[model samples]
Target: MANDFDTIKKNANSFIIEIHKFIRENFQVSIGDQKKYLDSVTKDSVKTGQAKLGSFIISVSDVLLDSMIIIVYTFLFLIYKEHFKLFLAKLIKKENHPALMDILSQIKVSINNYIVSLIIEMIVVAVLTSLGLWIIGIKYFILLGLITGILNLIPYIGITIAGIITVLASLTGSGEISVILGILIVNIIVQFIDNNLLVPLIINSKVEINAFVSIMGIIVGGAAAGISGMFLAIPLLAILKIIFDRIESLEPWGYLMGNHVPRKFAWRVRRTKTQE
Candidate 1:
């Protein structure tokens, strides 16, 4: 038990160190010249990015949540086999049992297709993240690459929240307090990289919505679809905003839903100073 604990702790420390390096690298991406680069990325690129990011996050979160639900319900299936088995049994009893086989075959094909799509999306994320980590000179670049790519699939605050959760989990399992500190420091640095650099360039450039709208979408989505909704809502809204932006009649609505390219810097500065 002691050895296992020690091993977990060591792994946790390594994980934290890697995470920090990833963050530092992510932040190094150019957010574009405040004056010019914004004009370069098209509205379509923003819409596509938003959709891709949203779909990835929602799908990952859904799978995780579904796994949790399955675990919770597993014991019930065992104890209440008669009640649970009835559904499958009834299907088996159908006159055209061959149809059942066809249905099962279709289900299998669908599952395989879905899994393949997920793998492809994950690959894209990993490549993008790994490139960033490599540039940042983070160790265990592959691991950070996978994590950031997967985590980004979650909408708005999902990636940030996931990083925090991962750091906290690592800290709790770590044997040395230094491991915890290491993880926290690394995450902060990574987030700085993401927020100040990578995200501003990738996410903000694509989704032209303001902070307030994003927050509001998260709240409403969370209420409706729970966490899954929150993750999906932002991208969905961004798509709507994009279409709205193109039409004169709907431009005002889009403006309300979307964000201004350059928010009031002075107001943000004052708000930050006040918080400080």
Candidate 2:
């Protein structure tokens, strides 16, 4: 746990430092570009700069405000969680109340275990990534590794962003396209190992939620709640499945939420039936 925490802290520091470095480098480059653009433009330079600044401020504020609201809501929900459970119980029929409580308990347990497993997996990924990048003598390996590990939390989208950022950082640091390709190869190898070995042993065994369901949940979540929704979706679906599986009428929906067999296996079964 201490080691995990250290890795997170170290990675975070690296991430921030690399961001600062990138910004500094770009700012230096953009200075000449901006001068050329402003000189070429007919509009008043000061006014244009002010307008751009205003727009940037507004966009940043909107993001910050939304994030703060989410944090506050989450805090309040945690504080009143027990009361919320009681509130839920009161809404249901007395006969169904026990079953509801049972379902909720299962949901809580499943989510908790899944979260723990994810954290462990992330720690392992971060450590290995940092080590690998360090071995290859990448300048911002810590930052890239940290970003890669953290982004893996979001289904489908996160790793792609990680790859782009890491590759760009490599390009900036080394000025070599070969380094970028190397990073891609390392990323693919790490991702392959993670998906096949680490995920099955850690996340898949515990979550039992298939990739299709998880991806759909992530998309739906993003549509409904933006980034937070994507983070919340899988757990929400997992909880829904627990409830659906428990209720007599909802068994079919629970199965729908469950993992599907491999396509090859399904095809084989279908062929056997056709032969029969």
Candidate 3:
């Protein structure tokens, strides 16, 4: 853990150094003879360089604080969990208690299934990606694959970012354009398999929402709260869908949000003569 932290810290500092150098190197040639503009950009660049160490310190502090808060909250939630269920039950009338229980149960099962599927999918993707890249002779394949797999959790956007990064890594490692193209092709194939086979079998089975709606939710979440929001949008939508489906007036909303398809229509399954 300590070694990993040191590696990350070294990489972070190197990244900042490279950014500063790039800015300093390019600003003179890229811009015209606008003295005021150049001066402002230079000042900002200097400020950024100066703040690099401070920013790293702040990030570490934030991680520690967040971990501490999560530990405290987890302990509290575990201790008072029954109380929470009681509080939820009391929110509705006694006559509606059973329906409320069913709704909450649905939410619990769906979310738990979704979370488990995600962890499993991420592990598979990471392992496969790393092994594939290694076989293809890419440097630092393990690190790249791990990054790609984690990013892949963010849905559509993650794969795009991973593709770009993989291509860049390939180009840098091999200095051959062929390597870049190979990486892109490999990534595309992997993603196709993930989308059609793994994801449908795992995640989509649990949280069946409309693709267009899911994309829009991710966009809205990204706009509202950045990466974390985008990462959480689908699962949150699934939970909301369960609640919406249970409430009489909100059933229409849930229906609109879902895939509205039968499970037999799975991509991998062929239409038999009887079905046809």
lDDT to native, each model: 0.58, 0.74, 0.74
Which predicted model would earn the best TM-score? 2
Per-model TM-score versus the true fold: 0.42, 0.64, 0.61
lDDT digits (tens) for residues 6-30 of candidate 3:
5444554555455455566787433
167-248: candidate 1 lDDT, tens digit per residue: 4444334434454465445555655665565544455445655667867777998788765676556566765675566557
| Tens digit of per-residue lDDT, candidate 2, span 155-193 | 556678788777555544444445656777888888887
lDDT preference between candidates 1 and 2, better one: 2
lDDT of 2 at 74: 74
TM-score of 3: 0.61
Weakest lDDT window of 10 consecutive positions for candidate 3: 28-37
TM-score of model 1 (CA atoms): 0.42
